[model samples]
Target: MTTWTAPAIDRRHEPYRADERTMLEGWLNYHRDTLLLKCAGLTGEQLRTASASPSTLTLLGLVRHMTVVERSWFRQRFAGADLPELYDFDADPDAEFNTVDTADAEADFAAFRAEITAVDAATAGRDLDEVCTVKRRDGTANEISLRWIYLHMIEEYARHNGHADLIREAIDGVTGE
Candidate 1:
């Protein structure tokens, strides 16, 4: 087992000082960067390797899934654009895990990077008080503030980064601050 340090967020350069929105965005950025760092220098096979029965998730799949999620939540839902889905939900929500082949490594990384770049652009110039609507899993629509979206994205990245930490550690016994 390996111990994981929480991702660091530099507050000094934040746009909003010590406000909740700035803190959340900073944390989200930190975790997103940390995830990319963890995947660095890993072979495609290592990135795609799945552990035993208890956990079928892989770092590669998580990367793919997170890319999709960021696009779906921020780019599509919040932005109110009808963007095409990244992965076919009708096939399997776990498609990222099952569909990854060694040959797809470069493509996957490219897509992930592109998604993040787009997300950054979409978020730029947006105020924390902006409102957005999203369809819930149960078919009900709820309006959300940009502040909530930032906070939720931060939490999502933080939780998944913990999983990435474990998976990367298991892959090579690598540990970091």
Candidate 2:
């Protein structure tokens, strides 16, 4: 299996004139870039292949799922906009994995990239302390701070990016580390 070298973190240490907003933006950018790096050079079949038993998740599915997640959290929840869900939650939430088949890699990447662009546009000029209401999975509504949402998004991407690292490594004997 290939090993994955994590993306560089130089931006974390660099000085920025902007305040917390600048720092948060830097972190988000780092994670997003790393996610792309992990997907680089992978074939569509490789991207969709399951790693092992018990989990059907793949790098492509993660990309799809993350796009949905980013859109949900930032675009809908934070922006307080009534956006249509990307994937049908009525079906399996894991549909991203089960639905994967041989498809155009470029198209998949483009869809995922579009989600990122939407998220960035929705979040532009928003302050960290901004509050928004989101419907919880349990059908309860709760107010959440944008700062917490940003932090959670970063954490979510970071965790899934780790999965991407492993899945990409397993597909080929390429070691990034």
Candidate 3:
């Protein structure tokens, strides 16, 4: 029985000698891949293992959550694509994180990859200064820029990648940036 493992994150983010968009996209992609790299070499159940009691976080959950995030920011918000969220928020808030024990990790991984491609397509040929109206969590809307989205996504990945580090360590005793 072969256990599924996350692919290696071999590419490094661009540090210098790149334009603004190139640098931003490069960093974001690095973080995005970092999340998957953290899950490499783990079975679906292992990816579903929570770090500790009372926490529903798992690698699969993170994949689902980030998929939604990418869809929201790039497709829905930026591109003005009208679409419902991937997960049901009314019936089950935090469903992405809470309901991953039986979730298909490979499928979610594929979906995440697809969403990334879609996001890239949505944002391509757009200006960083181009602003879009985003509904905030507090029910207030504000005009935000593509640059902000890129930065927010980078930070989001960084934050989740931190969680991923701990989860991976707990799962198989593998650790590193």
Candidate 4:
């Protein structure tokens, strides 16, 4: 028997009948749920286990990284709120993923969920076409729309969920998010 367990978020895909914003957010939520499902029932140390040798990628790391992404995209980039990162990217560029060993999985997961909840609240009743100017890591300025943020987040979770799939299976022989 396979050892698959239900996660907190439903694994259902987005509904077919929805508007552009609804569809985009739906897909993003689905991918986010997929990533969480990939980590379900694993312990903190198990979460910190590296899937590929010499690569620091872990379920906990992914959760932490996405927490950073959600805060950056919704609070800072989309809503134009000037907020410092939860993790110091300048001092430790890869702190989110690299600091997994020291992280408490339960607290990190709660923080990730909180960020998602905050993002949803921030973007609610907002127009998708609203543009926000962002300064990139290389100091190049670019304007991006709220719609692009949704799409980008969807892609981000989807790509990372793929790695989560591999990592989870490596951990427990569990698969199918």
TM-score (all chains, Cα) for each model: 0.84, 0.85, 0.94, 0.92
Q: Which residue pairs show collisions in model 4?
A: none
Q: Please list the residue runs of candidate 3 whose C-alpha ends up more than 4 Å from where it truly belongs after superposition.
A: 1-4
Which tens-of-lDDT digit does each residue in 27-102 have in candidate 2?
7877877777777767677777787777887878888888888888888778877877765678876666678774
Model 1 Cα lDDT, one tens digit per residue, 1-177 = 112222333322234566665577677777777777777777777878775556778888888888888897788878776788867678887777777754366677788879988988888878877888777889999889878888788788778888888888998888663
Q: What TM value does model 3 have? A: 0.94
Evaluated against the true structure, the overall lDDT of model 2 is 0.75
Candidate 1 weakest lDDT stretch, 10 residues? 1-10
lDDT of each: 0.76, 0.75, 0.87, 0.86
The residue ranges of model 1 lying beyond 4 angstroms of the native Cα positions read 1-22
Q: Candidate 4 residues 61-158, lDDT tens each?
A: 99999999999988888898888788877889999988876777878888998989989999999999998999998999999999989999998998
RMSD of 4: 3.6
| CA shift of 171, model 4, Å | 0.4
Better of 3 and 4 by TM-score: 3
Clashes of each: 0, 6, 3, 0
